[model samples]
Target: MHDDHDHHHHDHHGHDHHHDNRYSDMQARVRALETVLSEKGLIDPGAIDAIVEAYETKIGPRNGAHVVAKAWTDPDFADWLKRDATAAIASLGYTGRQGEHMRALFNTPETHNLVVCTLCSCYPWSVLGLPPVWYKAPAYRSRAVIDPRGVLAEFGVTLPEEKKIRVWDSTAELRYLVIPERPEGTEGLAEEELAGLVSRDAMIGSAIAGAAS
Candidate 1:
């Protein structure tokens, strides 16, 4: 089933406005710092933009999507991923810093998985690239565990009432990657095509894989 939707009118009752404001302030400070550094010839604005662009386009969710697609097509790899996610993922050439230790949370018809770092923003940067600002917010960290269903609702993901919501806490030592359920009508699709259906949020459990069209 297609479980994801655009949250055009989601309620923000669960959000901590204070945290949002702080995040905004932090971003502004960062931009100001970047400007000062560039003016002083201490940093190259073009290089900074290039690095950010690489992460956003080349090294981001596409890496995770490839892994998910491979798992969907190869049972042996899927088994290996279930057995040792870190090694299985590394076998695909996706390995490094924040992703040194990894775990794969496979979503199923009866259950959905959501990942969060309660203590801090411990994320799998190797595959998923930089984490989203919301993922690092204090509100998200605290609420994802206390009220996962409500949190998912905020992301426009509404699971069946009978389906269980499982929340995984990521740590500096180990991080998680959600493997969303493969959408229906995709049996004939190739792996590359399948990868296109998986979104960054889907792998994080805030959204579902796109339904085949």
Candidate 2:
């Protein structure tokens, strides 16, 4: 009986070890992809650490917030963004390496858009500044694709069943920016004031733009 129990325990340990190995392998794959993208000029390797540090310490999501606010207040600019996201975003002087190729996904009452880099964390540094730590995590990358609704819920975002959720996978060649629906009660607010209401999580499609306090 002792030998049999030991064998079962050993098997369990082996199973757990296998799972750990798999997780580690996934992380290594993501790192390899990041390297390749960096080499191809799709990602700035040197800037990755620097930008993350800047945003985490000094910079904020104000750049993206301004863009969203402008789009909300200016119909012509919104049209331009819809037609050519890269040029429009650049016109606002928010252009950089990873953000060279951009696409804007607008959220509507019928559909919601979520962005994720399943292979690696490709983000718009010029607009959103730097990605959050969770954005680069293995769990978020995998789960964002598999169970996006559940992931959003964890971020305190809940959508109605009638609304369809669309997840956009960011690649080395292209990145996505989510244009969250403008909140109500801001009709009288100026563009700058309106920008204050936009949040990084909202632009990431993990949360909605909350009404100004």
* Each prediction's whole-model lDDT (CA): 0.87, 0.82
lDDT (Cα, 0-100) at 212 in candidate 2: 27
lDDT of 1 by residue, 34-73 (tens): 7798799999767877767777677888999999999999
List all candidate RMSDs to the true structure. Answer: 11.1, 11.4
Global local distance difference test of model 1: 0.87
Q: Compared to the true structure, candidate 2 yields what TM-score?
A: 0.72
Tens-place lDDT digits, model 2, residues 1-213 = 011112223474456553222335666677789878878889865677786676676545787888899999999999998998888888987776643588889999999999999888998777897799999999999998899999988887878988999999998878888899988778999999988888888888988986321
Error of 1 at 90 (Å): 0.7
Candidate 1's C-alpha runs over 4 A off are 1-57, 211-213
Off by over 4 Å in 2: 1-60, 211-213
The C-alpha TM-scores of every prediction are: 0.74, 0.72
For residue 133, what is the lDDT in candidate 1? 95
